[model samples]
Target chain A: MSESTAQNAGKLSDDTVPSALMDGEFLQQLRQQMYRFSLLQLDDPQLAEDAVQEALLGALRNARTFGGRAALKTWVFAILKNKIADTLRQRHRFVDADQLLRSDAEEDIVDTLFKESGHWHRQERPAHWENPESAIRDKHFWRIFEACLEHLPARQAKVFMMREFIELESHEICAAAEISVTNLNVILHRARLRLRECLENNWFIREG
Target chain B: MKKCRDITRLLSEAQERELTPSERISVKLHTLICSGCRNFGSQVDILRRISRAYVRGAADEPQREEDSGD
Candidate 1:
């Protein structure tokens, strides 16, 4: 055990976990953050609460085994992410028929950005974004990005998050969302278009 | 014959799967003339990168507070 602990510690970027992780107030804050993160992805309060509870319990049970390798928050979130995935998989199997239809019935945003001739709308054309790479390191940029993500229609945001943030394969997302490959592509296409437009309007263009 | 709208869909689809030769060719040809489609392609790529960065940064929030305090 000590051998493995030393090896893990060596492999990690941070050798020690901060004491703040142990503070009661900090733990409470972490719990709230986890709930918000899960809710954003899961979009169901009950499931989000259950996922957070299970993750926290698992973290507590495995606390000694944590070995001061990764940040406690990161470790907890890793567990929470797994919990959310499992919950999604389970829910996917029993997804309500009405919910599935509703998700499919939602109107597409693509039509608004394109003319009847399938060309870009004059006012909707994408503007040149200078140095978008530099925005990744800016905290304010992330805030705007998150807001833009939140602005996405629920189904679009959920599918987009599963693909991009959770790093799930397209097939996996299709299976989870009960969407066909073609349908998945359309949803992703719409999501990207809107997201690009939102960030361009809110951040990049505003900066210029 | 592909318009900017069709080219943008192909661009986004490329993220999910391999585009067929003709589809790829159409996108390549269309984007060459259409600055708007070209910009859309790069912006979507940026969206993917930003998403990954966001995931990594999510857990760093509290840590950032601690670092500033120290």
Candidate 2:
């Protein structure tokens, strides 16, 4: 466990609270954050919306045990993370964390090298690199990226998507993923490195 | 042992304004002298800008009240 995680764990164990009534406004805000959280995890806006609905129902039913020690948002995120995990587990048997990290690392290296060599730049410059201006026009590029992502283990993919695409705060990501701060950081680091390397060697240096 | 590449990994969070203080310092100082890290940092910065643009566009969506009327 990282120093920060150990610290967070201490804080969690130090305080305990039973239900504190959340007003309507609090609930609305909670719902919105959860919606975004789910969206980050699933990457499908509709699926994320559904996950929030399910999570909200779960929260409402379990409100009596809601500990006020942590902020309601934290508790709510914890629940939503579990819900997302459960959903993913049901849909995909398991995601191999180590393999996923390795694959991403491979791809990042490839992509980086590729870009460095100016192969992708020569291909027909993408109007936008991250999410091509026209996904249809850049379908091939996205397809390759997506295929690389699909090769990742589910948990790593989830962490990568949440941090990279969803842009969630690390603290919230830890809470949502129920991972320790160090583990979360490690996952994020591996994900970014792999993507960087992959993007460079494969897509960026395709011609090279 | 950490190398420039290893240190560069943390810059993604640093650029996102997400890294803790020590991390920010380590990544920042490393990039200053390491050409590989500098390039990596630039790439990450570019990606961050793109992500921010996408997220912002997500909000460019019409207001709830206006959409309800439509």
Candidate 3:
């Protein structure tokens, strides 16, 4: 048997077969998701489109060597993430003045969680999350997590994603989001607090 | 005494930058007595781990199989 056939025979299933890469609707949905993710990071529609196009092209060009160890979506996202990082680095010099001036309109969720004396509000105290590590292995837990992430205010969600998901440095995020270091910290703090509370309410407490 | 509010912010900032010696001591002391803030700190750390796992496509794995439409 040829090399490709031999490789297929060793696999448990055909999900990773190169032919699976040709699913038109699947590819289209992947492209849209990539574009949405890129847009969230880049914040410019044109740049996001170009980054997705480039990433998809790069994925296709290297499709032959895709060993199927990772799901194709994961592989594609890895490529798009690199593409976004490159775009962010290159566009650093042209900081949009408008972004800097955008109002911090999102009400501070952190403030409400605390009180006048800086104590946790009685009702807002974070309860213990039992065996959170195990929740990582539970697929339903992630859906709740994503829902909480989605509920964050747009600015908070963007800054939080850049810090936690993209793993951007503080300086890189400040530059990209056109915000001060202090502002970034506050946004991250609020995001974390909100996400923590959200997961506590929606998942941990519910599960308990 | 450092309030849980400030202690939690310090914990979050700890993720981004090194805390001052005084800030570190304050957090250590506060969380020692405060269960809520203590839980907050670990939850945020778990948030970081979950975010990393999500990016690595942990959450997408099952969805991918469903999308295969065999």
Best model per lDDT: 3
Residues A95-207 of candidate 1 have per-residue lDDT tens digits of: 45775676554544567899989999988999889997778767788889989988887778888888887777887777878778988888898889999999999998885
Candidate 3 CAPRI level: medium
Error of 1 at A43 (Å): 2.8
Please report the candidate that would top DockQ against the real structure: 3
User: Residue-wise lDDT of candidate 3 within A85-163, one digit each (tens)?
Assistant: 8888666553444544442545454688888899999989999888977887788988898899888877788888888
Chain B TM-score list for all models: 0.82, 0.54, 0.84
DockQ of each: 0.48, 0.13, 0.49
- In order of DockQ, best first, we have 3, 1, 2
- iRMS values in order, in angstroms? 3.8, 11.0, 3.3
Displacement of residue A47 (Cα, Å) in model 3 is 1.7
lDDT of each: 0.77, 0.54, 0.78
DockQ of 1: 0.48
Clash count for each candidate, listed in order shown: 0, 32, 0
Docking class of 2: incorrect
CAPRI quality of model 1? acceptable
Which scores higher on DockQ, 1 or 3? Answer: 3
- For A1-208, candidate 2 gives per-residue lDDT tens digits of 2344335434432123223323455456656766865775776677677677665555555554532323444555666766776565445323346654665555454355335533333332222233433332343544456565665555666777666555566766676656677777667655655555555555555554
